[model samples]
Target: MTGNARLDLAIFDAVDIDTVGAFYAGLTGWDIVRKDGERFGLRTPEGQEIEFQRAPDHVPPRWPGQEFPQQFHLDLETDDPQAQVERAIRLGATRLADGPAWITMADPAGHPFDLCQADGVGPVMRLFAVTVDAPDASELARFYADLTGMRLVHDHPEGALITDGERNLMFQRVDDYNPPRWPDPAYPQQAHLDLVVDDLVTAQARALELGARRLSAGGERYRVFTDPADHPFCLVW
Candidate 1:
């Protein structure tokens, strides 16, 4: 790899990786590239892949569930969302909201996602934009932008949006973002985001200063931390 990772994915965790992977594989015609019990990789027709990890304490999000809000979601490119929703409904996905241009929905695992039309060309295709959930929209955006050398690309009702080179992330605001259930609820988020940082140590420090909870510390080159929403993110070398 040159400097940054080649691609990014807006992932959703599931209790059963096979069940979840089957749903998506059927939808996109993607096949499994690698499966090692806990982790799976689904490759698109063009060779792009999406990974899903089997979580130990994976809790299927309850859409209108107070404790589990829609944090990160996938955006699929489909010509007709209505048609896709109809089909997905039969396959265990539910419609959260639908409009002419876009439709927000949930997978069988209760993870949120969206389906929209693609508006790009050739190999430079734009899939779904990643949403970064936060309580203090402005603060989180600034922290992430400063840490990643990215720019505040835009703003929205829930929160702000930012992009670093090819990486596009949306910040959505949530009320009372009490992190993960942790050792108590046994519903630790099985999924996490891998963020490339300039300096893993410095980035970890900065994140901690911003209320990020350190999950594990030590010999590994990366550090894991929980966001205000209880979702885990990694500071990768």
Candidate 2:
């Protein structure tokens, strides 16, 4: 993997699988790739991956002993943030925040995503990478290599980190990585990460078998699903 890497955020949570699928599939143009009872993936023209998890009836987070700070957020880049925000809202992304610095919205599953103005280009944004969110660092790191047909690069026992032949992403670990709440009048979900794939159908199926929770979001040539951890990410072709 090179130093330059684009981003496809992977958010964690235990929420409705189809709900998340609708969130991302509506926001990004990623098509549904595979489908199972629970797990699935949204495919782009290329093959990137995101997923959701169905936890054991989890509870939503409350920071400040009442309202918790947003544990994590997906950062998206675009030429026009305002236009994108409008599109997201129209496509079902609930507006959590709308500020000049950034616009925060949620997927169907209630994860926060940010459409902030680019902070220039980071050391790893010019290339391609799929950001993964996971509890186990080692397992996800290895998973990226296998999934991307590449090898592991750096080792971050604190979290999962991997790289494809040309790009890379950090499998971030958050002790309080409680996914945001969606559909709540008080606080809605923020944003979602998008992925790309070569073949939406095959990739979506593969993801489902790997423990992804499929959503009702179906595309003629793609699919969408959530991973075991409940993070909403997608694959595209």
Candidate 3:
């Protein structure tokens, strides 16, 4: 892909687009940029976009388990995690787990995300990272780092982190990791990514060489592919 693919959008599947979009909008204070019968889109203050697609048969992931795995999740940072956790609960989130400096919660659509305590001054709530579950964190991190040209800031056996200065993509080792079977609602891809590229053909070829499998489903303007870990991502122009 010439290592120039830009991670454009992070997308999640939801049965009720409006409810899921409203929940995240209330939690993050992001503006709802687009909403239609088929999809909903929200934009972060930094201009990063998160989209929800209509999936009537969408199946929610089962976090902390491999049977119906949570393939990906967002990590949100805030100065006061406790208050944010409360606010999120009031906004229709259910507390999943708690830690000293972080709290895990499931959104209305059953997507698991974290409210982590941040050290520096910033927005009340900001997206800190988008973490993906993988059998080998280092391997997945390396694949993305090579594809997107994101700098690998941290590399370990258990986990890995990569950033493009503005956005962070993390990978964590999951025990008995179960990859999604896309195009199959029973084993739905709870979330996926959209990578923007200047040339679709070139990017698709390079991505295939980097262990991405091109999927049969795609539109003329975009093509779908799965990463090394079977996480569905798109190459869009």
Name the top lDDT candidate: 3
By TM-score, the candidates rank as 3, 1, 2
Candidate 1 residue lDDT tens string, 25-73:
7765667787778776776655545678876567766554547655566
The digit string of per-residue lDDT tens for model 3 on 1-237 reads 345598888899999999999999888888899999988998877777889999899888767788888899999888888888888899999999998888999999999999998877365468888999999999999998888888999999699999988888999999888888888876789989999988888888889989999999899889999999999999998
Lowest summed lDDT across 10 adjacent residues in model 1 is found at 1-10
TM-score of 2: 0.46
Alpha carbon RMSD to native, model 3: 1.4
For residue 199, give model 2's deviation from the true position in Å.
26
Query: Compared with the true structure, what per-residue lDDT tens digits does model 2 show for residues 33-130?
Result: 65565665665444555566554353443322325434444555545667778888776777776778767676555556766666454322122344
TM-score of each prediction: 0.76, 0.46, 0.95
Best by TM-score: 3
How accurate locally, in lDDT, is each candidate?
Answer: 0.65, 0.54, 0.88
